[model samples]
Target: MTYLRGLARSAQLLGLAVLVFCAFLVTVLMLAAGGMVFGLLWVRPLTAYCRALFGRWLGRDLSVSYRPEPGPPQPDEEGFYRHDSQLYHGPRFPAYFQRVQWAADDPATHRDMAWQLWFPLVVLLVVPIGLPVAPLAVRAVAAWSAWMWRPRPGAKERRRRTDAVLLAWAQCAALLLSAAVQVALLAVTLACFLLGFGLGIVFLIPTGITHYRWLANLRRQVSGWGGGERIERPYQPMVRPQLRGDGLYRVRNSLYKTETWADFNARWVWVWHDPATWRDLLWLGADPFVTGVLAGVPVVAAVYGAFGLVLPWIWTQAFGADWDTWYGAVAGNRLAGLVAGVLLVAVGFWLPPKVLPPVSRWSALLLRPTAKEQLRRRVERLTQTRADAVDAQAAEVRRIERDLHDGAQARLISVGLTLGAIERLMDTDPEAARRLVAQARETSQTALSELRDLVRGILPPVLSERGLPDAVRALALDTSAEVTVHGRLAGRLAAPVESAAYFAVSELLANAVRHGGAEHVTVDIRHRDALLRITVTDDGEGGADPSRGTGLRGIERRLGTFDGTLALHSPAGGPTVATLELPCALSSPKTSTS
Candidate 1:
């Protein structure tokens, strides 16, 4: 019985080996012919077959470790699917290419390919030893397959190290390229200045100064990529020429008939007078020399060390060639030259990650915006926010007026007409008059109820009476979901701040129940560091997009009046959290809670 089982297992192994060999040949041919997508089609079934053979014959489990397939492409607002920056009319091509890239990039795919090539050889070498050694050979083949195909431990760490080495070399290359661009731009700057000031050809001055700004901006952007603080642009805002009542466009004190020369003069003066213009010129002249040294050391060391020293040492010792280089000979000693070469190569690899961050910091000293520019930007922001607030207020007033004219006011007028009718009918028909009075009373009550609802919509009664903390608690009670409120405020907030916060919370709670299908929710309100913070969390189907919903945008506009912000984190599956923050001082130090 034992011999029969061994013979059966040996036959199975022999068949599998032949099948894998044919598959390997086909895969290689398809790959060589530039049909990689078709080639990868062979790897999946081949891996599955190997895994099944190991499990069934040897009773050892082999797991398939291929990465999950990419999901279907999602379309944008215009109903077009986007891959990278290009928009596709349909999802078919994008999805296919995405899968191709996914498979090609997967480490398991490569491992499986390697196994297909090796497994056939293993079977040929070990299976020819006859039936006595058949079971042993099967076990050996299974072990080899398991070792090659299983997920490698510490793979992620290895990948990270590989990435760091690549990034360091890339940064070295980028720095050298930037240095070359700086040298070219600096020459253009001197020529422009010479032409503008020396020969009175002033148009070239602004042209050159404005054009080279792109390079300065690129350096500023590159600083942040090296894991350093971001540098902000320091130039003043450009103001266009405005036509005066006299039908002339004024740039400064000078006025012109047509807008063309006025616009040109305005732009020229704008670029020439700004302090950042000079600072940019100064940075352009200095960056190549200062940052150039930091970037050059690693590259020069790596190139020189590899070709100049290491290869020369190899030539002298291994090939019996003369060592005649000026730098790598190391006093006519080959071993010393080899040691020096290895150390220099190590230095080249180690220096980029260490020095790139400091290079960014040094660039920031000249590239960051100055104090005057900062103040100017702040004023511009405030002016814009104020305008947004005024527009929001006007819209709110119009909404209230429209609601009153349509709802409560119309109901009250009908009630008054019914009362007059009842008075005229009192003597003629007592039963009809009594019915009219009853109808008038019911209509009046309905009108009053509508008035209360309208007021509540503007400002909830609970909010004005008890402040933000208690008001939020009342809100949670009215909601359909099970809601729990945590934390308390030390005192009442300013009226405008409290009102803005109350409505913002109301909007989030309504959205959670209506759209999210949430079963439970939590509201946490606290005052810390002179800021009123409220967080509303719900466990539901999230995927709340502010751009798609008007409720979230209205909440944003309302909060913007008080300089408050709403931050939402709602992923696809469940659990959405909305945080509202408003800066205000607490007044009357009495604890408020529900």
Candidate 2:
């Protein structure tokens, strides 16, 4: 079933990839040739935009697998919000309609899509743009689709409805007269430019600078409250309360709550509207066209020419060297050259025509600060999700502990008392006594298993019995990866610290085998001074965020509780290396057979 499901998923991805390729082709034809209908604009490859907006919703579901709870996320305090001039937080949209609010209701940061902002300017500057209405109509469709007819209400549905009506009127008027607005703005910029750089500076510099200053002030106002401080008067529980006014936290509290975001956005959006400060996303598609040709033309040339030749093989390898002797000699020389040449041709020659331009365009579209800010916000969401998951795990540990004491441990105590009573009666009644002894034996066995499992849950005794070295050796033997243990332990560590370090390495190795698909794993334990370090390196798929799974995160929490540390460095392609360090008392400076 897993194999069949895998094949099906692969086919689905392949189908989507083909569709995306076709859409890009369609986008090219419609934009270049004035032939396609306006509704066809969804073919412009809107994946990136859609991905950002929906990533959090997807991530929220994703977190549950990492022990995520169906509850609140963290940073649930004031500093996370925005503050006003007087440090009051702006109003925040409620959770249910947050995405909708972001789209239609976020007064501070909604800029129409880039092409929507650009084509009118193009029509004004040049007349050659065919089907100018295509771009405008596309924007109208997108805007409508985003907020139209959806069952849910946004943060402020009434405001959005009014705004939509107003925008509809503005858009129609703008469509009729955008050429005029473009020309007017051009005239103003030119009139200013006709004067010295001073006129341009006067028009542009302050526009961006003022907004930057205001945002800086807002960030400072909110963050300053993070340090614990109070207004002078202190309070006792049932007595008078403490009151000191730093004004920072009071403002942060207001911002962290409902009011903070509205105030912050009011300032932040001012930065976007600042003519000098605002990023012109129209540049996203534009600069790529120019720079892409400059960069891509050369690559195109290489793909066709020297890059082809450098693979160091010829025609037979391209076709193949016959099935049995695929690696056999060609022209009395090994076909390594021929095989490499074919791969280069496939990667370079066939792929570039399809790959380069859109990648450039997508990259260009993502160049602005707001896009970056959105990505930053996405990461923050995932991080907070992880934090909430960790909290849940901590709660689960407590529950498990309570369960053992109330259930298994209580049962064991009763069995022990009953066994004692049975022994007292054993001599009086022989057959009944035999049955009681058998019952006691079974209960004892069960009690022993329960105790062992509980202790394993707490800390595996392998950690102390053989220290880090033997514990890791045992873990390596347990995994499918070609795991090798190297180096020596200086000696014993603080028992708790040793246990935490050993478990951390054990979990990391387990992750490498179970999830990483690692074929080669190296575990190196070294002690220097009072620090005991274990490094687990694997040749596998890299991107294992410690916050993404319970294995890594559980290790992290355990280490934290033990005054130990864990770190990972994994990049794409392969090769993940995780390092753990714990302070321990060494029996000697160093010891090794080597």
Candidate 3:
């Protein structure tokens, strides 16, 4: 039964292997259609499919987050399209040039290309080499053990000796069959390489690109099976103008990235020579070998038992011979052989299923990334986070400038105009002058209100006067929704971080009241690991999308400048939690004012 199950599992893997092969071919063809400069456009979805497959089948997940592709240019509410030139410091180029330029400038694209180049070989080697060993070994072991304790001297002594010799030969045949399968695997590997490289050299890049799309998919499977951490390179490609001074800045920018070099090294050197690769090779060999040992014994026994049962009947029918002569004369009892064969076949079907988990885990162990790669990935993330912080700060500055110019400044100008009117009317008619003075006073008050709001938007006076903890508590008191503030810092946070935190909370509370329909909100704050953690929870309509609204997006941008992260958890029905983390130190007790 175990052996039968093992064979069934093997059958499933064989089917998957076929799919892998076909996917590889399709990927190559897709790449060839173009330079596959847009290959990632298709490749990412395929990668996701493979990620899902690995997670479901092998318990491995390709946990990768890809940046969204830029969509078509959108017009503002006023029906004007703001060109990227306004945002970017570099001189603008044609839209087509920018698209191609950005695509070429991406490090991930190059990584994709590298992946495409090597994937076919990886799939060709890994699927056949890694998948088949266990079941075959199970068959071999089954053959040896099936005759280990047979009915002694049941027939003539001579017949017994002949049966013993035939059984030995059957056992040898099973072992030889296992060896043949492995040899065949090697032969196929060599043939694939020879055929692929020899015939497809001219089309290598395209072929590789396509193959890589699938190969990455295969790796995802391996990764899931391993249940180990995945190392992702964390660099966003610089999309600065690709043509500076009429030179190819796109190529230059791509070359300049550390991510590009990491990818290049991985493709050309580390992929081949890395210890992780060797470990994968070891898994490729070891998994089948172990599983084969567990399952082979029963499978081999069944094949021989089935053969023994069927051969006699066929021979007797063909020759019109007696049952005893045709069936019993050659080996052992005909009925017994038939029964054994049927039972063995059942075992073969059952045994293979049992080995799947262990085999998957073994595969995973070999496939996980090494420590060095993990550290490198961490550094990459830190670098990207730092860059985001700088960009967010610059954007915040611009936003503040724009607000001051358009809102408070405009209001002050209106106030000045009203004052001038009052001055002109003063002597012409005293009663009219009084009315003008009242209008001017009202205009001045409105201007003052606008200025106060603008100033508060920049940095609330409460945050500076009362310290962060009190400011937040005061914020909760002012909101229409019932709000609670939990946790406290021993000392005050740095002014910038405190201000960022204050606004972030304010925006969230506003959102909860305005859009969330939230009746109650909770703000939980903590100081740990030289970092400030704030969690804002509200009983509200649950769906909160970072991409949908300007308010939340603005909060995110503000927090990002302080190297703060926001993780929003909002389900569709009700309740939302926004967790924000920022690295910072508390001011000393002497300096702290609560």
Candidate 2's TM-score: 0.34
Query: Highest lDDT among the candidates is held by which one?
Result: 1
lDDT assessment of candidate 1? 0.84
**Most TM-score-accurate candidate:** 1
Clash number for candidate 2: 14
Tens digit per residue, CA lDDT, model 2, 318-406 = 76533322333334454554555455444433433344334334333323235445565456646765675578568869977897887
As for lDDT, the candidate ahead, 1 or 3, is: 1
Task: Tell me the number of clashing residue pairs for each predicted model.
Answer: 0, 14, 43
Look at candidate 1 and give me any clashing residue pairs.
Answer: none
Residues 223-325, candidate 1, lDDT per residue (tens digit)? 8756897677889878589899999999889998999889889998899788898888888888898778998888778878998999988877888877685
lDDT of 3: 0.60
Worst 10 residues of 3 by lDDT: 142-151
Per-model TM-score, in order, reads 0.52, 0.34, 0.44
Off by over 4 Å in 3: 1-391, 549-557
Error of 3 at 445 (Å): 1.7
Off by over 4 Å in 2: 1-400, 406-408, 420-429, 460-462, 477-482, 491-497, 513-520, 527-533, 537-548, 558-594
| lDDT of every predicted structure (CA atoms) | 0.84, 0.51, 0.60
